[model samples]
Target: MKSIDTEKINVGVVGLGLMGTSLIVSLLIAGHKVKAIAPIPEDMEDAPQRIREHLMICEDAGTLDRPVDCYLSQLVISEDYLLLAPCDLVLECVIEIPEIKRSVYKKVEAIISTDAILASNTSAIPISELQKGLFAPQRFLGIHWAEPSYFTRFMEITCGAQTDAVLAEWVYELAHQWGKEPTLLRKDIRGFVTNRLMYAVYREGLSIVAKGDATFEDVDKAFRYDVGSWITLMGIFRRLDYLGLKDAFETYNRLAPHFCNDEQIPPLMQNMVEKNAKGTRNCLGLYSYTPDEAKRWDEAFAAFNVDIYRLAAMYPSQREKKKTRV
Candidate 1:
């Protein structure tokens, strides 16, 4: 992949909610000029303030180099779509509704330059489905960023059937330039890579709890203590290869029955959704917690991610490369 000329590139992020705010922070820290756009009038007022907050959090955690104010100066927030014309890359992070996404994309397509790459942050929508009504489908793709996009380096770059390969490759390279560890999806698949693997585990986990095989805490403990640490460094495939592929596959085939089958949605999850019990936001879901408790959980999640990134940075090859680059 060819390197993006960081000095010449301007990134525009649409949607100033949690994910969009995080992306702006990441781009600012990577030394890129960023323009953030939000539909709500209040977001135009709060974008820079929120960006400053994120920078302060990073600085407090010792992950950033300078003051929050310094980074805030690099971000520009606008309510008009025309302000995005100068952006070389525009990432759409609106809510997951199809009509809402399409409406936003239409506005973005009108304002952005013909050469600008348009990407969606949708987790569940297929890239092809999103590209269907677009005039220039080749310039559009999916950039699946995990939650809290600032600190987490994993980025999945997926392309629709109509997406240009060269453009996809350019986006992949640009992600690295912005300090992301990006993986390219050669073909668009439902749920993408990370979600597919995670949902498989989640299905079984929910099933286990539903069947009274184990409590939620017990199931979480099995993964948190055993698989979590190892999987951080080595992925599932690599870990299996290290353990001898033949033996691993044989064991999986035999023990697979003990795991949950491809069954209907667990009753508990359906009930929660029906009641509008959306985890911490609604203060009730699989677990119940107060607003303060939810805030603590968010902090713990951020800190855990920070530690994971630090460990990833410590890879032997990465260490040597850092020295050589210096």
Candidate 2:
């Protein structure tokens, strides 16, 4: 088996949903050869076009330096699992079903080299649970990526009970090459870090609305205007420090008891799910939208992502600091 080369490695992605194709673009941009496996027939038919469109968006956003074809040429999309034989790393972005994921893992493991790493892009599944039955459980881990992988700098590299620490560290470092600010979670936990934090906010937001303290629109405005203002520049902890720890301490003490602690799913969300509401995708959501309104919201979000991607680059997490006086 060939050794893993951070500069020019062969990476394979199994599953070709929107996130999978977007991730292929990120890998290609990072100068790696990518093999994408479309497990479902529908994805197989749509993967190539979806990839092309994402690359085109990158070009328009001025994120793609070379001709789009240059990157696309380095990708191979197929149903053949054998093509993954040369991959140094393979990440599965399939459904969150454990059975389906385990089956894909079995197939990929049968073809790839022993040294090759296998990972999943599961958002909420515990990495420890997913690695339970894998042939080489030590090599299996979780590498969660935010949507629009090429644009977002968010990534989380998680370790299961049997994960090789050294291998996970290598991936954590390599994630920087893919333009991510990756967090390494040495211990596995359900919902990982991002989901836990975001879901807490979601629960509180939903509860507030359900209790008549605020409407959905009111919560959305507060989140967008307040949290959205400084969240990009500084995360929760840092913002607390930036504002003043004393104020945060006092607020937390006063508000802790009143915050939502409901263990059950929020009724508003449950109702929406029961109605098959997919937000902007189907013009049905917390707030109703006409078909054209939904389309506009969808387009606006894509454009916003591009703008924010560029803006965030200006204040990167690793920005070099100026020397201070002794």
The backbone clash count of each candidate, in order, is: 0, 0
Give each model's whole-structure lDDT: 0.84, 0.90
Lowest lDDT 10-residue stretch of candidate 1: 314-323
Clashing pairs in 1: none
Alpha-carbon shift of residue 308 in model 2 (angstroms): 0.8
lDDT of 2: 0.90
Mind giving the per-residue lDDT tens digits that candidate 2 earns over 220-308?
88889999999999988989989989989999999999999999999999999999998887888999999999888888888888888
lDDT by residue (tens digit), candidate 1, 1-326? 43477757888999998888988888888777888888878888777677788888788878787788777777778898988989988999988999999998999999898888899998899999999989799989999887676778789999998999899989877787666778889789999998988888888888889889898889878888989878767778778877888998899899877987766877878898899998877678687789999889878887888888788776643324554997
List runs of model 2 lying over 4 Å from the truth. Answer: 1-7, 319-326
TM-scores for candidates 1 onward, in order: 0.91, 0.94
lDDT leader:
2
